[model samples]
Target: MSFDSRSVVLSWTPPPRDNNAPITHFSIQILEGEHSDWSRYQSISTQNSDLKYKVPNLKPFTVYSYRVVAINRMGASEPSEPSYLMMTARELPSGKVRISEAYSGKPDSIFVSWDPITQEKIHGEFLGYRVFWKAREEDGELSRQADIKNPNQTKISLSNLRPYTAYVISIQVLNPLGAGPSNTVLVTTKQGVPSTPANLSVTSVSQTDISLSWYKPEHSNGKIIGYRIYYNHGRDAEIYTVNTSSDYNIYNISHLMPFTRYEITVAAITASLEGQRSQPLQIMTDVAGPG
Candidate 1:
């Protein structure tokens, strides 16, 4: 007729007087508070064995009361279980931990870092972690693994990774009861020859503009999408964009201040991330005077 614990299960049987006859249906109702009106009424066929139902998606840390009634084909029967106290689902009794950052430090490895969960109000005991990760291809495919146990250690290094690959990481907590869900995080590894632009040359200089080009590395594993060209005559830096047709050759950059030395550098941009800068290229424009 009633649950002994705070579980959100409702159970009932026929009233004492109606035990001999076949019960037609059962009705269950929920009241909001001690004096509030009933809010929900659910009916179940009598043929259902065990006569138990689970209430879902209820508010946490709240009180509720339930009552049940049995019915017959002729008319509705009297209430069986008058009322009993029950509680809804409570929030997870664990601390809040977060994976702060993940990145590639070198060519073939990645580092993962996280922050500790410091909540002091959790009643449940401390437990280990469940780590989940997926490797993504350049063509947009995702592969996932079931929850895997992680040691209490805060940082982990993943090695033997391929160049120009993207991976997603996630973490969750586990207790005696079960493991919670995971929160998603993403990271990408460095690709080909550590893109660095250097040794820029000015092909032509003019009063208001200049033409420039740079040498590309002989070999690289990563594809260079474009370049970020930076130039500064004074305190502020000006920017220009150069598109890469193919990594086989040099880039021509134009525009400048006449009779001034311009400092320039180039950065390699990939599909997922930007590469390191090349050596700085410095050039001085030709002087302009009365013709």
Candidate 2:
């Protein structure tokens, strides 16, 4: 039997030695290479149905072997000879596409652009490009699709997106031959100041130092580069810390007055902006330790 360039179809007849028992089904086993395991590929339930089976999704640059086993009331029969071979498609896709996203100034839109593979590498007749995206949020996932009918089309602007939300995206090129593998990317819509950090607390305190911890914002629109720390008897009177990735959850504050109480808060930071401060946490340092 024949399958696609990267796959093969297999068929076989039942064993002659039935021992007066009727055949029940057949099982196909596959091995990608000599060192690979013989795993059951597929099973057929009908005794005399289409004994043929199509096995697809084979890698182009690898070798494979397959065998078949017949079963009846007694047991399974001896495995058949291994049919081993290599497969290749008419033209595999070129892995030279680039994808990027940028803020489009629209609060609910982003500009997505991509460069097609070089013409020199496109072995098959180009058909078009298909772009797929899914947004993941607290409630659930939402999916959207877009495409360019012309193979030469390069850029597309996606609108009506959620601000400060992330979208998983990928693109694949299609040809008369088949659809090639996809290039995937993650894009976070433009973000604004994040919500306040959560669960701020005082982990430890001492005569001259205080330790503080806090959870990240419930929704961090983009990658959190670091955090800013503020502490003073008053509201962030002092920029206690800045540009610190020091474990967003914990921070040790040294150089505090003995037997003194102070107020502190934290803010998450991204590439270009600092988020709102978390609720204040108070720390009362113990009296001076025995010097």
Candidate 3:
């Protein structure tokens, strides 16, 4: 007997006497696995005197055995001895990897976990797993891949990624033959502090108040929640702070001492953290006028 991943071929000698009548046909019986009973599978006509038959559509990585019975004018004869157990060759996996969890645990990285493929789905020897990821806005050709050689590992961390950005991740089971179908998930990195506020300058000035305006930070890692205005009368004087919503980029600092020099700086804030402050801007309030 000979077999492959899906089919088996068997060759047997004819009965010694054909039961005194010419053999008309042969009935083929097959048994699968250990618990299955033998059953009729197919019949072959003896017109060509062929002694070999090929059974098709057998499952891969399975155990099977076969038997043959001779039939003539009188009737069907007794069955022959069963053939030895035969096993089919291994094939590629037929199932897909399933992702269980995917989320951003840090500002610059994402964590992913998945359930391992069952042994029955992995038709061949288990080799490892392959992970593929890329920015959500990037093309598929720009994706990066990592191969984990250990079969026991089911989770991985993808680091060195841009903060507050979306990414697409995929996982697949691997074997010597090839890789199985992959499962995909989308995740976004956690929010990070914004960059320094840009173009800090004095927009207007008066005897007791100063108005300032500035551009948004070049890199706002997340939605800009607000801005912090930091000011002090002099190098040693007490520092005071004021906050403005993201709706306004200009702020007016009132109730200040006239004819006094003030040092000022600005910083952007997100929901999670504050960013670096901008360079200090020095400005003098207008002198007090005669009442």
Candidate 4:
């Protein structure tokens, strides 16, 4: 018998005693796996006279054995001895690697772990694993990859990631032939402090109030929940603070001394942390007029 990854060919000699009647046909029976019962597979006619038959469409990496029975006009003969066990050649893995755990370890890194492929699904010798990742908002072509040479290593930590951004991660098993289908997961980095507020300017001012306007920070690492405005009349004067929601980019600070020069700075705030303040801008309120 000869076999490959998906088929087997068998050759046999005809029985010496054909009884009184000529041989009608031959029946081929097959057994699969270790404990499977025998079942009829195919039948061959004597007219062909060819002693060899090739069975096709067999599964890869499976165990199989075959037996033959001869039939004549008189009766059917006992089954012949079973052929030696045939094992198909191994192929690529049939199952996907599963991501069991994935989460942000820090503002700039993520931790990931996966479940190993089962032995039965690993059709060939396991070479290793490949991990692929990229920013969720970026294109697939920009993804980065990492190779794990050891099959037992199923966990990895990815660093140098953008804070407060989402990422897509994929894991696949590798064999001599190629990599198997990959499983993917999505994770987001932890919230981080925002960058400094930008473009602090004094839009309009009055004797007792100052109106300020500014642009958002270039890198708002997380959602901007609010902002803090710090202002003081002079270096030694007590600094006062005013808070405003993210919904507004302009704010008016009231109850300031008339004609006083004040140094002011602005900083952005996230739900978890506050960022650096912008460069201070100095402005003088309009002088008081006759009431």
lDDT string for model 2 (203-237, tens) is 78889888877777876655677788888864436
Question: CA lDDT of each candidate?
Answer: 0.60, 0.70, 0.82, 0.81
* TM-score of each predicted structure versus truth: 0.35, 0.42, 0.78, 0.76
Model 1 per-residue lDDT at 206? 66
lDDT of 4 by residue, 179-205 (tens): 888999999999887888777788899
* Residue-pair clashes per candidate: 2, 0, 0, 0
Between the candidate structures 1 and 2, which one is better when assessed by TM-score?
2
lDDT of 3 by residue, 1-291 (tens): 888888888889998887568887787777777556665344444443468878787777777777888888898878889888888888887888889899998889999988888866877788888999999986755888999878889999999988888899998887778998888999999988888887877889999999988877888877787887878874655434445545447778899998999888888888878888888888999999988
Candidate 2 Cα errors over 4 Å, as ranges = 1-103, 106-108, 111-133, 136-140, 144-188, 234-236, 242-248, 289-291
CA-only RMSD, every prediction? 12.1, 17.1, 4.3, 4.5
Residue 178 lDDT in candidate 2: 63
lDDT of 1 by residue, 159-200 (tens): 766665677777666555555556667777677454565455
TM-score of 4: 0.76
By summed lDDT, the worst window of 10 consecutive residues in model 4 runs over 40-49
